[model samples]
Target: MRLPKTAHTSRPWRIHEIAGDFQVEDVWALPTPGGPDDLAHLVDQFAQGKGEPIDSPVARALFAIRWKLGALFGWDKPDGGVGGRLTSLRGRLPADLREGPKGPDLTAAPFTSVFQTHDEWAAEMGNRTVHGVMHIGWVPDGAGGYRGQMAVLVKPNGRLGALYMLGIKPFRYLGVYPALIREIGSEWRARAGQRAAGSAGAAGAGG
Candidate 1:
């Protein structure tokens, strides 16, 4: 579900340290609820591309259209991406965070991991339109369990980038994000079911 920007800003996330100049474009409550240690599993799912909602036809079509547009316009040229037109956020990391696990290389997205901690993981990507950060945190649900929260932060390139973000806002809210939430929930449930089945089989073997 879409959340207020405070849902991300209010937290003590390490992302705040490095991405202060970027604006918070969106915040979402992810559906992957679990115990404290489960953030790693959630991050793994993302890195493996198992939880991306782009598999949904609508989301896939939208992404394909976006990529085609980018290709035609030179928006995604290598020179426009991170480490080219934009400096990587990794360069801004503090000493401790820089030395920590940089998380896994994502198979689904162009984002490169910046840092990872027990409860937070951050990755970044850039193009002609913007330099963006995807920050995920495991937060207490107030009901004892913990769930994932995602925040998107961006520094737009200029007028073109601002207009592009404005143009896509409707489609993102109406189609992409909803499908993303549903897919993540479905994948999380499937993983839970597999774990349960494995435990049951182990119990049966012991019996």
Candidate 2:
């Protein structure tokens, strides 16, 4: 999460947000053709900072155990294409991103082609060109089709960042990402609620 002392060009989509004790600064240079102007709204929304990506109890619980399943066993890799891809990215992946959602999807693939360091991630994406979002649900939607991949910017506290699609592939979204997102978000939210309740209970008992 620590950034290198060497200064690199700040991304146009940079955002600053504080989550608990963790201060987050994220940047993504997506290959979309819309250019920097394309992200004005995203930056504004994230800056306003309403949604707590990690605040929900569901996400917290899911995120807590996710590393175990997704990282160690790699069962989280939908089609099993990415189980071993991570080992090859050792020096290539910066610590901030060394651990993340790994998968066969373009967004989570072993941090290889996209980048190794934060600077590289930003530099590589600068002015890059790629086939734009093309279609929403490319594979098909909930039934055999993907739930459409949408480009979103993510910033984990402490400079971890990326502008990538929340890719929901055929059955991947409905069968996979959607389920996981809800499951994790739900679990995380519940845990946070429990923590709040515990604190309140302790206060009442003391009173």
Candidate 3:
């Protein structure tokens, strides 16, 4: 993915993809290692124990949500894209794609796959290609404060890809992200729990 380097703590997020839907839960990194196996494992596990398709409505909904995410967060351009018709948006997307039904190929394939797939997505959108770059954020360890975390990504024009790499694993559904946020916030508040009491006693005795 070769994302632009930014302060890890800049754009943060808690993973909210899967938990009850699947396993292999963990934070996602840009350009994840061992592309093929890592990706195939997701679909493989989805069918384990039960059967193909996993028999999970939530999983299906999650997939469908990320598959076509334009409805979640509004697009960049309000008028819609070209001449303010259907393909009119605020910014342009990555290059190489041009035409309708051509959207970001969240497929585990190489960048070329994304280009080819989005070409069709553009065509379907009245020949107006998208304009944006791959966006992913990370959490950096903060000094004198709790640790940090971040969002998997912000798709082009908020258009989520077909394969949600985050959902490949489960545990995220239990609200891992929300928990993280609360944890961090608690750390910043008045420490009144046993741990804080222990710390105070230790400091008093110079231990």
Candidate 4:
């Protein structure tokens, strides 16, 4: 579900310290409720690319079109990415964060891990249009369980970048995000079922 910017800003997230100059583009409440310690599992799912909405045809098509456009326009050239166009957020990490788990490399997305902790994970990606961070946090759901929260922060390249973000805002909100929410919810439930089945099998064997 779409959340107010405060949902992200109100938290004392490390991303606030790292990406202070970036704009908060979107905040979302992910439907992946579980135990407090489940954040690691959630992060692992993302690392494996299972957290993405790849099964959604609409999302798949949009992604294909965007990549095609990017390729045609030289928007995704290596020089326009992380270590070239923009300095990596990894360089700004404090010593503790630098030494901590940096999460796993994402095979599904072009993002690179910045840092990871017990409850938070951050990754960064950049292109000609923007330098962006994907910040994921495990937060209390108010119903006694924990769920995931995501915030996207971006630093646009300039006038052209700003225009590009503006142009895609509608599609992101209307088409992409809804598909993502559904896919995440479905994946979360499937994982829960698998865990439950595993527990049952263990109990049966012990009996």
Each candidate: RMSD to true structure?
A: 3.2, 17.7, 18.2, 2.9
Local error of candidate 3 at 75, Å?
Answer: 33
Estimate candidate 1's alpha-carbon lDDT, on a 0 to 1 scale.
Answer: 0.90
Q: Return the candidate ranking by lDDT, descending.
A: 1, 4, 3, 2
Model 2 vs. true fold: TM:
0.23
* Backbone clash tally (model 2): 20
The TM-score of candidate 4 is 0.91
User: In lDDT terms, how accurate is model 2?
Assistant: 0.28
Worst 10 residues of 1 by lDDT: 48-57
Ranking by TM-score: 1, 4, 2, 3
For residue 131, what is the lDDT in candidate 3? 25
TM-score of 3: 0.21
Local accuracy of candidate 4 as per-residue lDDT tens digits, 89-193: 999999999999999878778989999999999999999999999999999999999999989999999997899999989989877888877777777887887
- Top lDDT prediction, candidate number: 1
List candidate 2 stretches off by more than 4 Å. 1-86, 93-168, 197-207
Per-residue CA lDDT of candidate 3, range 1-207, in tens?
112324322232111121111121123232212212122222212113122122345554554664355445543244554345432221233332223223332332111111112001111121122322221222223332222222232222222322333443353444333343343334324223544575568789996
Expressed as tens digits, the lDDT of each residue in 38-151 for candidate 1 is: 888889888877435465788888888999999999999999999899999999999999999999878878989999999999999999999999999999988999999999
Worst 10 residues of 2 by lDDT: 129-138
Candidate 2 displacement at residue 79 in angstroms: 16
